[model samples]
Target: MGNKRICVPNKKEAPLFSWPWEDLNNYKYLLYGPLVSKVLYSIYKEEINNVDTWCLHILTLFVLRAFVHQLWIIYSNMLFLNRTRRINQQGVEFNQIDAEWHWDNFLILQAIVASLIYLSFPSLANLPIWDFRGILCCLVLHIGISEPLYYWIHRLLHCATLFQQYHWLHHSSKVTSSFTAGHATFLEHLLLCIVVGIPILGTAFIGYGSISLMYSYLLVFDFLRCLGHSNFEVIPYKLFEDVPLLKHVIYTPTYHSLHHADMATNFCLFMPLYDKLWKTINTRSWDLQNEISSRTKSRVPDFVFLAHGVDIISSLHAPFVLRSFSSIPFSIKPFLFPLWPFTFMTILVMWAQSKTFLYSFYNLRGRLHQTWAVPRLGFQYFLPFAAEGINNHIEDAILTADKLGVKVISLAALNKNEALNGGGTLFVNKHPNLKVRVVHGNTLTAAVILHEIPQNVDEVFLTGATSKLGRAIALYLAQRNVKVLMLTPSTERFIKIQKEAPLDYQHNLVQVTKYQAAKHCKTWIIGKWTTPREQYYAPSGTHFHQFVVPPIIPFRRDCTYGKLAAMKLPDDVEGLGSCEYTMGRGVVHACHAGGVVHFLEGWKHHEVGAINVDQIDVVWKAALKHGLNPL
Candidate 1:
């Protein structure tokens, strides 16, 4: 049982020893606000009086540790940076991601402890800022005392009783991120403080301590700890080959990854020398690191879903920022309040670049699937000056996907805007012989909206009646003898769509200019963004089924609102660690699912230009047959 891996739930029974404020959730960070304020005041006091730098040094060290850990987090999630070099190929699920949300709690605990230490010990206070001799003393103490002490304690924790109660929390994450290094129970972290403090305090007891030693020792300790849990192999294998003995002295990300996978081996903190002396090292660590490093080519996916940022804030919902945030349906949170300025700066930087970046990927049915993003946000698609730039990025993505031999590339959200590039028709027309199939996937989007209406309903009100999806929906319903109240101001566009229906059904399609015409209509299909005043025209119990981007708000309590069209992926899908915007786990927008269905059916023709109204039921049935359930 000690060697077995445990899968913790996102919200589960509290382990034996939990953090004091674990119940606070996101607000737990507020617990350290007082200490942070004190640290800031200490900096001001030090500059004015030159009295002591103890509090200032602690603050600087804590900030440095956080910066290093955050850097690793960003680097690990960059899929464009040689994904094959990642140590763990298995995706991290929401359960593990959510559990690690309080990873920085350890640092907060340490800051409070340091404040107490300063108050109690006067001899160690007001020390000089630099001492070269103290650095040598610190290293000696760490190797002689801290290293051996931590190794034995770690091994003891692996015993059955302790493993089940405490150590299991740290090992719960099979796929490690930099934050995983600090993801442990209160007891474990408290013990870690002792192991970390021994070297610093020992140097002070010997009269060799200085502020430089404190910063250097703690920073290196944090840098190495974060490096081991980074889930990406950064330390080159040639270094171990050149030094020979360095393999036993330092641990790599792959070495620590093996320990998480198999709990019985490689049980050392940062250094592999202890594991080697105790015969606990995993035998496969060295060979595996070299194997992952030697991979020169990246995996080419079978299908690609080209997505774009919905807004300035929601754009940070990528896998790298916070998996837990991205895994759930997005909403404005108090925690994100301070990040707006930084996110705005990032948007400005993205606007200057014209590259399509890889966002996330997974494996399904022996084929690789990927999601790529055109660096433009949803609002940018509307600006007249930005249209040409947006189209160029989309075109670049298509040409690149074709070069990589991707079978299908689906344009999603604003990437397929009819006004911008005629639903991706511009690309297909430019490159007539391209192997990759460019798909707007609007057929599936229309099918999802159409099938949602109750079969018993005879008359339905439609908005954006002249649009691609609206036109298809109107003609399809008219052929079934169901009257469609098409809402449009253009008579020529409405006449063109109505004539496509049979003569017997042409009279069933009626064009109405105002929302008042739908006051008596019970079912409303929204293809455009609607205002609350317009929504007031519908009666109680009217359900608004929409294909609009960023979905409209439900202003009326008496009426019902349907989310944007989406489909749940098949259960057999593997490595789907991230959620599509505002969708739950394993759910994707209907257009994205359309591309998957197109690939699975081996369809050859381009799904770009205008959607085929006849293929609506065909694509819907195929999706259902392949286990894509409508949401």
Candidate 2:
């Protein structure tokens, strides 16, 4: 039988459900703000030899814990690695992630308690910086007292009454991340603080404690906790083969995952010795760990949606970071402001590296699909000299996908800009014999926009009329006998698109030079970004439909603004933990769905260069048939 899945039992929120600053949202960080300020002010006052070290130590520990968790998250989610080693294949959705947003609140609570302890016992202050005796005392006390204490308390929490009241929250995440280690009720975390404190306080009260001992012990505890919950198996089984007794000395991620999967077994903190003594260790732990770690290669994706980063701040909205933030439409938030400098540094690092990296992936109808990101930022694409560099990234991604047996690769956002690479025409023409189909996916994009326009509307104002999508839209509408007021400064370009229509229906396409000509028009198709001044020309009831990247600001409150063309994915999609940019769960941009439809239909042709007006309806029909509903 396949690995048995244990469902988390339904439970109400624990009685002690709320965090200190639960409603503060991002401002929750302000709780520790005074502590941080104390550190800086103490340093500025040249008081390093004084009590400032306590705050410094706590701050450093918090940073280190967060770093370790993030490092494990990145490692576990990496697509290029051997994914067969992944323990829990089920995805963590947005709701579960949002519930876990306060995972680190336990650290903040513990730090506050530590501060109170330091104040209560003045003897704990200004301890020696190094003490070899204290280190040994910490290790001894932790293994003897903390490990067994934690194991028993953990088992107790699993008992029906406490499990339903508190522990169920921790077990709720079917696919555990590093943060999963801390996602517990306040009561459980309170118990954890006591379990952790006994080791350090035991050393301190015995006159053996030191700064190094405290820091090292707690940090090691955090590191091991994160490792155990980090769903992917990183520990090698050969170590156990070399030293057979070591399996009881320490626990593996696979061992811990079994606890989540079966619930009644493997209830140890860091050592399996306790579980073995209690006979709670799972029978399949060793076999499964070896099975996963023995694999060398990751599965290949059938399709790749080549996406690019939008901006520095939004970069943190990936599956690895603020997952709660990424699950919804991306917007600038105050909490993200503090992270701008760090994200800016990351941008510098990405600029130096010139490889496409896997961002996220999911399974659709048993076919593996992945999204790869070009390291360049959104604004970088607009730079005059940056075109070649951007194209090089796209070409490299396409060639790499071709080599990896990726059947189709779609260009998203500005990656297929005409000015950048002729809507991906440059690569196809340059390579000439590529096995992988390069799709701009604009046919479905155009179809989504066209369908959004009401059929009863006879006249429409079209901006960016000479552009790829705009041109196709103009031709399609004119052929259907809808009067299209094509707005462009270039009369030559407008006429070129006008002639594409049949000779009988060419009059339906009108060349207009100013937004004033569209004052009487209610249906506005905006392929170009419309400014507030330009938007003012539309009548009060005008509905603005756009295919513009970044989307235009809704300046006219009186008018209704339609979102960018997008489609909801089929219900059968699996492991879709991350949202597609701003789109909600199971929803993706139309171009992304276009690529999915392209793969589903098993088309042999590449959808590059320009859109085929004839295939607009055909691609749209295929998308709907494949369960992609337009949003």
The candidate that achieves the highest TM-score relative to the unseen native structure:
1
For each of the candidates, the C-alpha root-mean-square deviation to the true structure, in angstroms, is: 3.9, 4.2
lDDT of 1 by residue, 315-338 (tens): 878887766577777778888878
Q: Residues 270-367, candidate 2, lDDT per residue (tens digit)?
A: 99999889999899989988887776756788999999988888787877666656666777789899989988887788789888888888888889
Q: Worst lDDT window (10 residues) for model 2?
A: 1-10
Q: Which ranges in model 2 have alpha carbons more than 4 Å from their true place? A: 1-60, 78-85, 238-245, 383-385, 429-434
In the predicted model 2, the residue pairs found to clash are none
Instruction: Indicate the worst ten consecutive residues by lDDT in candidate 1.
Output: 1-10
**Candidate 2 lDDT (Cα, whole model)?**
0.85
Candidate 1 wrongly placed segments (more than 4 Å): 1-16, 33-64, 241-245, 262-264
Which pairs, if any, clash in model 1?
Answer: none
